[model samples]
Target chain A: MDEEAAKKLIVETLQKKKGKSKFYLKDFYKMLPDEKPRTVKNLVNKMVGEETLEYWSSGSTTLIGLKGVGKQAGAEDEED
Target chain B: MVEFRHKTPLIDQLETGPWTSFVSDIKREHESRMENPKGIDFQFNQDCCDDLLGVLELSYEHGRTHWKHGGIVGVFGYGGGVIGRYCDQPEMFPGVAHFHTMRVNQPMGHFYSTKYLEQIMDLWERRGSGLTNMHGATGDIIFLGTSTPQLEEVFYELTHNIKQDLGGSGSNLRTPSDCMGQSMCEFACYDTQEICYQLTMEYQDELHRPAFPYKFKFKFDGCPNCCVASIARSDISFIGTWRDDIRIDQEAVKAYVGGELKPNAGAHAGRDWGPFDIQKEVIGLCPTQCMSWDGSKLEINTPECTRCMHCINVMPRALRIGLDTGCSLLLGAKSPILDGAQMATLVVPFIKVEPPYDEIKETVIEPIWDWWMEEGKNRERLGELIKRQGMQKVLEVTGFKAIPQMIQEPRSNPYVFWKEDEVPGGFKRDINEFRKYHQR
Candidate 1:
């Protein structure tokens, strides 16, 4: 799939999946099975760069979330 | 501004001894801060030192620690570099209730100038408990205690004024450290500081954010001497080494025999260990039994030599490490927590350590991370994961060959686990054939 279609699909998936804002980069790869993993990774990182999505990290693991959706820095999350 | 005058009769007893007390240091900081007081803004009304002392006294009284792990607290846009801590009895000691630790990434070899150190101390004094760990085991400049609110401010000051970044904490890529290789030591095979700095800069994102299942550390040692103790401490250890024969000076060896030069570069100068015996001390002590001395000179069996540095250490002037130098990449070393302490198992026998370190990153580091991230459980260390899965898995993932250097000796146990592919008929062999032969 193209970048635009993949991006739309990811947003839709994230939107539909209620009560869960954060996801692993692997989750995105699973979401777009048709696209190459490298392509999907690049596009996801591109979204992060554009602030369409932000990274939620627990120091041991990193998860991707829609911008302004999950806990930002210093947001009182429990230890992983 | 209020003076912290909490009575601590139990804690005070420790001050009478000759050894300098930590309580005294804290008290001094408290006194200094009180004299030049700033408006305390956090919910904890008293200064950090006051509350910290209060909590310690309470702990002494109850014989139990009151401190508990706090929620995730860190600088903006970063996941790690800050460890959150809280006191259970917040009402009794408000200052230390939200006490946190900020780990600042120290220089490569911890070669800090006075000005840089002063800048860090100044920032910590203004914002923290003034308790500093000169360097943590991971080699970060640890800012011991501060409030949750002050974390960002301290980070701002660190970045803006000191121009330094936070080190890794939690499960991220920890601050890479190295021995004083070319800076101080002559036995250094590679530039440890340069490689450490390069990897630190190259993997900045990995350091600041959580990217793996658990914490990963990179420690560089200049040579087999392992001054940094990376073999048992770090997740990935780069130990410098050489492939060529040891360089020997026959004249210098003769000088030591004549008592013209001191053995071990005068390291044992204070001790009267009698005259130096070249045969008994140097050649006799060689682990590989590779060295032999005739009447005229010493000869070494280079192929049999394991490069343990025993001979060279004893006679520094007479011998030197070979010129063809590189490093051995060992993996999965950690302190005993679950499966017990593990010295890093040799993964790469030798790799030329150079700028960018692309060979190591591409061939070893990235592959292992990719595998571990997929297979590793949460809170599990890399060594633990490697232990759970056999070393063969590691070799398969990294495309490393099975070399004799990977193991100390051949396995004594006869119960070998052979793969189905390795068997002649594979695992699907008919059970009827076995019954026919056995006549069950």
Candidate 2:
């Protein structure tokens, strides 16, 4: 899938899974099946850097949520 | 041949005990092997084990790997073909520690004379690991356990002695290998050895550079026999082929039919078993159903023959491969690592493989290097990159339009895909047309 489409899919999925507990980085990567792990990691990092997505860490695991969408998701799930 | 080792920190540790069981086991096995009629000489690589220990000491940190990890490294001058390895754990059993490997490119068909073999073996024994892998997956002679200094010396001497340098490393070509082509095989259509040599010589710099995103291998097979296993191993594969007819020797065929097939299996073997039923066997077993037996004689519809090695292997004396031979180029086959394992896809259905092989190199090889260098990701093999960035882009950039024969295997996965934006030109109204369009 194209980059724009992939990002769109990620946002939509995050919105859908809002308050459904957590959306871990690995789970988000799984959603982008065509993407390489490196590519997915880069995409995630870019999104988090730009605040396009909110990253918070639940213990050691990292989670990504859409920018404006609010969810307890989990504490310390990649959120600095 | 020579002993050129100095005891380091790791060596001292291994010899100071705790490896009593392992050492005794090795001695026991060696003793048993010595009992065999053809005796065995096992070189207990004490230095290699020590090196292993040293690596473990360096790499192991608390519960994980240390800072110095995988990257491009060698003795010096040489760019690739040497793989540096580290021990998984120093805290466990320290004896079996430093585990680095070096890859040596072999000549076509691996035909090494005793003298040359002895020379290279001497280098390995004195400078690095006495142990060697005859042919690894990349077709290079993997020399296990060598320090940075030792590796440099080996490379220097090897190039000076044989004039043949190390195979590719770090994103470049991984040695082009071929079977015993015209050298000793009657089945060989094109000169497999010649092409292998030509490619190695022409692209020496490329072979020694870390230019591409990852490793690219080129393996050649003399015929569909695929002795070199190009079909499933290489990024670029060349298989010798023909577009003509199979030659039949009726006299040889009749001799086999009249029970003279295996004249020397034993003194009375041929007379007792009688003749093979050619009609029931050879004719019936022709995969494409293209052969006919007219009671006494055998006739083969050559065009329908898939060159599957069945007929030639069965009746070696009677059937001869055609003269009008060339090669077919296949792309993107490799062992799984980042992406899943893949079989090569046919790129060029057929091309003339005459001297210099300009057409094949220019039309097929160069374009691929150019394209992959520009787009492929680091550590992404050619096959994986092609899958990631659509085969359609490869077709467009390489200018190799797809053909029916180019389907290396029936599509079993969704990895091979075409982009909606890049459509093929020329469409007519028919089912065959649809098939043709999809084939591209």
DockQ of each: 0.20, 0.02
Q: B213-304 in candidate 1: lDDT tens per residue?
A: 56799999989989899998998999999999899999999999989999988897887999989999998898989999996789999889
Model 2 Cα displacement at B54 (Å)?
A: 13
> How much RMSD separates candidate 1 from the native structure?
4.9
TM-scores, each model vs. reference: 0.83, 0.66
| Candidate 2 residue runs with Cα over 4 Å from true position | A1-80, B1-72, B88-99, B162-164, B263-275, B389-391, B407-440
Give the candidate number with the greatest lDDT. 1
Model 1 steric clash pairs: none
Return the top candidate by DockQ: 1
* Whole-model alpha-carbon lDDT for candidate 2: 0.65
Which candidate wins on TM-score? 1
